[model samples]
Target: MTVELTTLAAIVAMAAATVLTRLSGLLLLRYVNFSPRSRRALDAIPPAVLMAVVAPTALATGPAESAACLVTALAAFRFPMLAAVALGVATVALLRFLGL
Candidate 1:
């Protein structure tokens, strides 16, 4: 199917807007001087962001999937980061294979 010029332009604009929206926070952080409290809050943002991104995906697949993710996260916390991720992926794969 051929996309019309106007449709293509709209898609490009939407992509640009999405990119700018994602980057706006980082840009502001780089350019603005944040207070100590703000810095602490900023430090907390990553874990919060990670949860926000991962929670739904994990839960969407059910408790077993979420448990696998949690295990992987905990392993990563206790062991090598790469190993943790590998274990998590492997756990999910195994579970899928076993028909969980």
Candidate 2:
């Protein structure tokens, strides 16, 4: 295959994979009967996913970043998720600017 053809093939494969991943969730939901508790568990997926992604990085970074993560997590508990994220990011930026 030429370079252009190879690139095109790779792009097509990626698009196919993305489409399959997206569609699989909907397809599974159509056939699976979710109980109320199961639905609740599913609803918690996003935050659990967020913590899974964020916790490791927050822990690995230095004090300011760690503090920011705590602030963010606490703010998240007290306020809206968006507000909490904003507060966390702002706190980190300010701390970094101060050379902490």
Best by lDDT: 2
Give one digit per residue, the lDDT tens place, for model 2 in 1-100: 5569888999999999999999998898899998999998887666566567679869799888988888887775567677878898999998999988
Error of 1 at 95 (Å): 4.6
lDDT tens digits, residue span 38-70, model 1 = 888866655555556667778788656787788
Task: Write down the TM-score of every candidate.
Answer: 0.59, 0.67
Model 2 residue runs over 4 Å out of place are 1-4, 27-33, 75-83
Clashes of each: 0, 0
Q: After superposition, how far is residue 85 of candidate 2 from its true place, in Å?
A: 3.1
- Please estimate how well model 1 matches the true structure, expressed as its whole-model Cα lDDT: 0.75
Tell me the TM-score of model 1: 0.59
Candidate 1 RMSD computed on C-alpha atoms after optimal superposition onto the true structure: 3.9
